[model samples]
Target chain A: MAYSNAYAPSAPELPESFVEQQLDGENRYHYAYQYQPTQQFSSSSVMFPPETHPDIVKSFESADRDRSGFLDESELRQALSFSGYEGISDRTIRFLMFIYKNPGDSLRLGPKEYVELWNCLAQWRSIFDRYDRDRSGKMNSTALRDAFFHLDYMLPTSVLQLMISQFDDGTGKNVELCFDSFLECGMIVKGLTEKFKEKDPGYTSYATLSYDVFMSMIIPFIVSYD
Target chain B: MAYSNAYAPSAPELPESFVEQQLDGENRYHYAYQYQPTQQFSSSSVMFPPETHPDIVKSFESADRDRSGFLDESELRQALSFSGYEGISDRTIRFLMFIYKNPGDSLRLGPKEYVELWNCLAQWRSIFDRYDRDRSGKMNSTALRDAFFHLDYMLPTSVLQLMISQFDDGTGKNVELCFDSFLECGMIVKGLTEKFKEKDPGYTSYATLSYDVFMSMIIPFIVSYD
Candidate 1:
């Protein structure tokens, strides 16, 4: 139930200037720093990069119950939950680890990586809020298309229809996606495209895969999201 | 149970010449026409292209229970099972429909498209058999890699590891995949790749997608496979 209510859409709408700043690219980070959350964190001993928000640091320190200065899979899961990312899948966590974890370390996220992850999540959070125009905590197919178009994905209409149908709550005639589902969707696209690029370095839009290798690469993303 | 036994690996290995001919590209179809199944079909009123295999024709006729020339989703599903493709997911069926159904039609497959589908499956079946050298009804990570490599998809070890871990039966130390699972894996890779190519026609390997569009495109493949 906590996870269900994780994105209850209570935050005030972002001002028009904030949207313009986000479009200006470099200024987006400036706005993220300027934007303040209603919730406050208690002061902590942990020293992070000056750019790292205190809220993020508090969330991380609280989740790192062992205080190992590193967050393993379980700790990372807890950290995400504390940050309002509920029901985070192991695959998504691994994907986050794949992106931000230290090169030599495969399973743990150091403080720097944790900070980076928080920033990335914040950026995505802004994108989600921008498109959920009704502040209903969900977006219909058209809005979903506009949101992705704003991101430059240019997906086919059929593909868009398939997505809404999959996540449709069934109570309504229109397909609607909540914040958590939107995050999962974003990560899968980002993750798979990155993986595909490894083989298609030439950008040929064509890559051949053996049955098993293909299965192995994709099954995690597919199964975890389900 | 029949689906489980679908790829029992009882067929004799392809002769060296057949492998060489397959590598020669155009000669592969000639060989397909020449290769004969032991099972025989009785004389039938239905006429087919000279190139079409009688076994394929027989399978199609049997699955077309209503004597309709075209196969709807359920009929197509039954036809695939009759052709040794069992446990086929609805998503995959929709995918097949997407590929083979007529331009004006969204659901049914005419005989021509059905034949093309059969040929495509046959090609995939050979590919599966070729990589399954041990014929234990499964392939380990290395074999999976080689199989994909043969198909020109050079995926990273991390991706392959993730995939195997996903479908791993847990009863064994090593991950192994059966024919049906292999089919599902290949379809996901092929399906997602084709979808990605639509947006990345320039083959830039960098296509932007909105969270929702990305989710819609991928969720189908992911959920159905699971």
Candidate 2:
């Protein structure tokens, strides 16, 4: 009675599911800042109750409850299980915590933060594409360092410092991440900063270097002052 | 020092990475699996490790960390991240979690599960060679149900109970899972019970329905339970 209306197609249903040979089977999919389609798929298609795919659109749609485009987390949490990840699992959501809970504040992913996230994600695909050097279609360690190095990231100073220190462990053959490691390190730092700092203080160019490098590079002037 | 010993080549080694199909451009393979050949590949016809694609071998070798042959959670966690999952982010990892965790237990996918996954994958070759009944290269609900009803699944009571209950919801009037879901669900269940159920549930012909009937009549049962 309930989902019947929610899931059943209001539009003219096709004789079967879309015949895109390229679609992963059953309209199944996941959410990610990814550059490729997955391998999992099936031949089965549907002709009715056509709520299908990427699941993100579905989640957003469900959350918009009244058919409005905008969303709040409460509404999102209720209707969208998203196979188990709800809003808490969304990248835009995490980004909000970073934005609103400015180190001094404890705000959640507010509307303001949400807008910034949308802006970033809209362009993140192209950003990720540019750094994928091997052209394998993904941004791994090298790709990550390149993005951070060439582009402007709005990260905090402390996080930036950690980036430089953690990656440059003495031996400097592979100074910057290739892509894979970049994502790993970036995410780890993001997680820690969120839990401890409570907000993003912001990032610096020197954030790419460590304390020792900072001492040799920036301290010459600052320490002299101290 | 550790990696040095492994590099001694007994034969020619493939290039550190895959030879790009230059004319084609690797749009599809940007995030496909990477293989790196650590040891000098003795001349082989398969991967051309000693001469090329050694990196592909290397990637697989890295993923199979323990040399366990089949990838486990840790292995999959690490391996897939290289492809773009960013270490199974909550967004991307949701679908996998659903399949592996199902109703109970953290699943350890093995060769059987792997093969089924492959079977369900979309191919450019033939959609209807045999799998599709309507020449659509895709399966309609009836065809899907018929196959399911007939499988020799020694289903757990909970799973069976779920299926029967779903029958009551009536999604099965004339519907079936696309090829991929069908394989994933059936194969995982079969693999679990037959290969890893621990208790070794025996197959019972009596309880098993025909694939035709399952697609036709029992799919609603599955929907309700799910």
How close is every model to the real structure, measured as TM-score?
A: 0.47, 0.24
Evaluate chain B of model 2: give its TM-score.
Answer: 0.31
lDDT of 1 by residue, B1-226 (tens): 0011123343222222222231211222233323233443435444455566777887878887887677887899998898888876665675565445543343577666677777767776788888999788777778877776665555456555555554644222576777656655666555555445445545554455433333344555543211
Single out the weakest 10-residue window by summed lDDT for candidate 2 chain A.
A217-226
lDDT by residue (tens digit), candidate 2, B142-221: 45433433343223333332232222212223333333344334333332222111111232211222111111111111
lDDT of 2 by residue, A1-226 (tens): 0001123322112111111110211111122212132332213221112222434444445455555444444554443344243333333333333322222222223222333333333344445556776676545444564464444223333334334433432332344543333433443333322221211123211112111111111111110000
Which of the numbered candidates is closest to the native, going by highest DockQ? 1
Candidate 2, Cα interface RMSD: 31.2
Clashes of each: 8, 70
What DockQ do you compute for every candidate structure? Answer: 0.12, 0.01
